[model samples]
Target: MIVLASQSASRKAMLDAAGIAYEAQSSDVDEGAIKRELIGVPGGDVATILAEAKALPVSVGVPGKLVLGGDSLVEVGGRQFDKPVSREQAAEHLRFFSGQRMNLHSAAVLVRDGITVWRHCETARLDVRQLSDSFIDSYLNREWPAVSGCVGVFRIEALGVQLFERIEGSHFTVLGMPLLAVLAALRAQGELEA
Candidate 1:
């Protein structure tokens, strides 16, 4: 089994649905501080960097065992959104994204014995349909608690699916893991069945 260096429910669901064996644990790093220090870095690169930060820590604990870390971020008009800070912010994200296209960047890193081994990043484009103020309000009321933990304030597999009109990318990438690539990497490393 691999060590999943994140406690995100979405990531856990993705792995569980894939029948992948893993242990979930938090890296406990301050992601906000990393973002602040990397000011002006592109969203995709930031995601890749953060993935390594999480994976490296857990790899240290398990010695030679594989440790996986992943992160997802949303980019709208060059601005990146992390999980919402409040219900108001979540609503604001929806308002700005209404009738616009946003790119969701998901990245994963694998490490062994505290050394980086492999990494992958994938991007998915989502077109959010025009949304009315009432819809935004009701959406936050029903979904904020659940979605607030997700970047873009969405969990595309849930009510969040209603917010999008079109999506272009791998389904798993949008769900926040480059899962197929990750599986391929694991198999390549002799950690999973070939």
Candidate 2:
């Protein structure tokens, strides 16, 4: 069995949908501190770094088990955006994203006995349509609860899909878990059936 080190519902849904069996456990890592430390790194590398950080500690605690950790971030106009803390910030992010292309980078790592066995990071670009302030207000009112948990202030699985005019890359990448690659890695490691 694999151990999932994350509290994200989207990630759980991804694994469940893929038929990968995993025990969910929240990995306590100081993400804010890590983000601060890697302020100048590329978005995808930062995501990979955070994912490894989450996996290592949890893998150490559950020695010999397959522990998977994942992280995602939005890079727009050369700036990286994490999850929004408030509706206002989400609204602001959407406004800035209006009619622009933004990259969603997701990274995943597999660790066993505190050793990283596999790692992958993938990037997807979303082209958001121009949105009006009124639309933003209504969208926020409807999705803020679910939206705040995701980077880029959009779910892409729910009404958030409507926010994009076009998307380039894997759907799973935008969901904050590069799941297909992870699945392949699991099979290679003999944790999942080939």
Candidate 3:
């Protein structure tokens, strides 16, 4: 059976929509500490490390199971924006992204028997619409709780899409998994039924 080593609803939905059977289990890793520890690493490398870190523990515990872990971050002008920790931070993230194009880096790792079997990183560019103060305020009020950890301060599946002027990337990457790549890896590994 496939085990998703993440608590993300979007990732679960993606698998479900594709008819992939999997169970969601939080890896319970200290993500913030992991990011801090890998601060010196390149952003893409850091994302991959974190993804593997999240999957390794789960893979070790469940022998013979394929465990998938994924991570995403928003980068603007060489700066990484982590999930907003407060309402004010969310508003600020929106403001910083306003009228600017930012890159979203998403990395995924698939582990089996405590070893990484597949890994991939994908990036997407999103041009955020110029946000007015009022709009930012309203958006924060409505989405602060749900969109906190997401890189772009918006959930494309919800009202967050309205904040983007344009997007250049696969839908799955934007949602944080890069579904096609993951599926290809799974198929190649013969983990998913053909």
Task: Give a tens-digit lDDT track for model 1, residues 78-128.
Answer: 788888989998988899999999999999999999889898999999999
lDDT of 3 by residue, 130-184 (tens): 9999999988888879998687788999999989889999999999888999999
Per-residue error (Å), model 3, residue 29: 1.1
What range of 10 consecutive residues in model 3 has the weakest lDDT sum?
38-47
Global lDDT of each model?
A: 0.90, 0.92, 0.88
Clashes of 3: 0
Whose TM-score is higher: candidate 1's or candidate 3's? 1
**What is the clash count of model 1?**
0
Q: How many residue pairs clash in each candidate?
A: 0, 0, 0
The superposed Cα distance between candidate 1 and the true structure at residue 44, in angstroms, equals 1.1
For lDDT, the strongest prediction is 2
Error of 3 at 164 (Å): 1.2
**Residue range 84-138, candidate 2, lDDT tens digits:** 9999889888898898899999999999999999999999998999999999999
Is 1 or 2 the stronger prediction by lDDT?
2
Of the candidates numbered 2 and 3, which has the greater TM-score value?
A: 2
* lDDT, residue 113, model 1: 96
Off by over 4 Å in 2: none
Ranking by TM-score: 2, 1, 3
